[model samples]
Target: MSEKKKSLKITDAEWEVMRVAWTTKATTSKEVTAALNEKTEWKSTTVKTLLSRLVDKGMLGTKRTGNKFIYFPLVEERSSIEILSQELLTKVCSKKVGKVLESIINDSLLSVDDITRLETLLKEKQKTAVKEVPCNCIPGQCQCHLVS
Candidate 1:
């Protein structure tokens, strides 16, 4: 995959369609719609529209096989997830990132191995982490503790 395709902002609807393409590797619109329809109430046209949007975003590649088009992801799933994670992290205040992560961890169901991995990662980060993370949010966004 090209570096340019490494980061993509897929919409919620497009993400559902991409999940099918990523899992299937290569699939037709009919197959994609069927897979998604098992849990969603989207129409064939809706799925097809999302497919087209993904193709436009360069997230999904296409091949014309007979009359139907076979769609496949141009990027790997893991890389896309990392990029999206970084993108989301950048949107929040630096000081609040830890709390954000903690909330996510609290809400998630992780296996023993997953918890172990997180502990290891935290240890590694502890070595270089600052004593305090300064507020990175705009003045209006964060509640200042300093007295006026």
Candidate 2:
């Protein structure tokens, strides 16, 4: 299977429509509208507008089912999350990565098993990078404590 990538910017309304598409793949406009109407206060016309925008942005694909158009997500949620993560990292100072990670680790309600898995991953990464890696942050900006 070919992995086609597209840079589609998601808006709030578009995100709502995408949630429905992700749950029910190859869904019709009527199905999406019904789902949104049942779940949110958005009108059918608003959902239709979002659907058309998504199709125009190439984030969604359409196929004819008789006289109706069925919409399928061209981009998966995981891929979009990965892209957003990278974008966030790029925007943040390199020195802050360590401090940010530390905060996240401390603040998150991770289970014991999750902590164990994170430790295992850290050990693997430590083994791979024997030497200290350079900061991804701007000079003098990174607060990353990369060294053990």
Candidate 3:
């Protein structure tokens, strides 16, 4: 993650393919399509197209394994996730970030370890927590004094 990351805007379909490659370390198109089929109605060709697009976008790299190409994630999964999360958070008013995180936590199914991790993170963040988060919203998009 210390290495500079590319600003790749991955589509939802491409994310599905990337997850498979990241989980398996490497995969051929057949493996990706097979894994995706369990969760999506996408056909094999659709999965292949997404894989090709990811490769072109440099999110995925491939090596020829005899006659077939095995695809692997070029970027670390944690780095990619952080990039995407930050991108999403930037679209909303800064004041609403806590509410957004709360909503996400409520909706997600967390394991005991995950809950413990969040508690630890929250405790650390509490050290510098502000009394009020200032609204950093675009004008006309939100009701805030920061908005002209």
Candidate 4:
């Protein structure tokens, strides 16, 4: 299958719609409206509008099914997470990645198994990485390439 590299920023309302689309594979607009109506307190029209907007944003693709449109996610959930994480990391300082990780680990409640799994992954990464590599950032944009 061909891949589309564009990243779409999902709004709060759009995220709800995306959850339905991603889970259902290909769902009709009417089905989506019925499914989300009670939870979001949104009318069928609102759901239709959200679907149209998502399609325009390139996050979703719509195919004609009878008189209605069936929606499918053009972007996978993991791909979206990677794109957002990269964007966030680029915006924040490199030194802040550790701080961010610490905050996330502290705030999240992990089981002992989860903690062990993460620790194993960290140790594996440390072992696999080779000698220090230079950061590819432009000189003025980030301190990543700066030498002490």
lDDT of each: 0.83, 0.77, 0.86, 0.80
State the weakest 10-residue window (summed lDDT) of model 4: 1-10
TM-scores for all predictions = 0.88, 0.70, 0.86, 0.72
* Candidate ranking (lDDT, best to worst): 3, 1, 4, 2
RMSD of each: 4.2, 6.0, 3.8, 4.9
**Residues 1-148 of candidate 1: C-alpha lDDT, one tens digit per residue:** 1124234677878888878888999998899888988789888898889999889989999999888898999988888778888777767777888998999899999999999999999999999999989776656766754538
TM-score of 2: 0.70
Q: Which pairs clash in the backbone of model 2?
A: 94-137, 94-142, 95-142, 95-143, 95-144, 96-143
On residues 21-62, what C-alpha lDDT tens digit does candidate 3 reach at each position? Answer: 989998999998888887997888898899889999999998
Name the lDDT value of residue 90 in candidate 1.
Answer: 69
**lDDT at position 140, candidate 2:** 50
- Which regions of candidate 4 fall more than 4 Å away from where they truly are? 1-6, 128-148
Q: After superposing candidate 2, which stretches have Cα over 4 Å from the reference?
A: 1-8, 105-113, 128-148
Error of 3 at 139 (Å): 1.0
Give per-residue CA lDDT, model 2, range 1-148, as digits (tens): 2234444477867988888898997798788888888668777778889999999988899988888888999999888777766555555665455666788789999999999999999999787763544555544554564435
State candidate 4's TM-score: 0.72
Model 4 pairs in collision: none
**RMSD in angstroms, candidate 2?**
6.0
Best by TM-score: 1
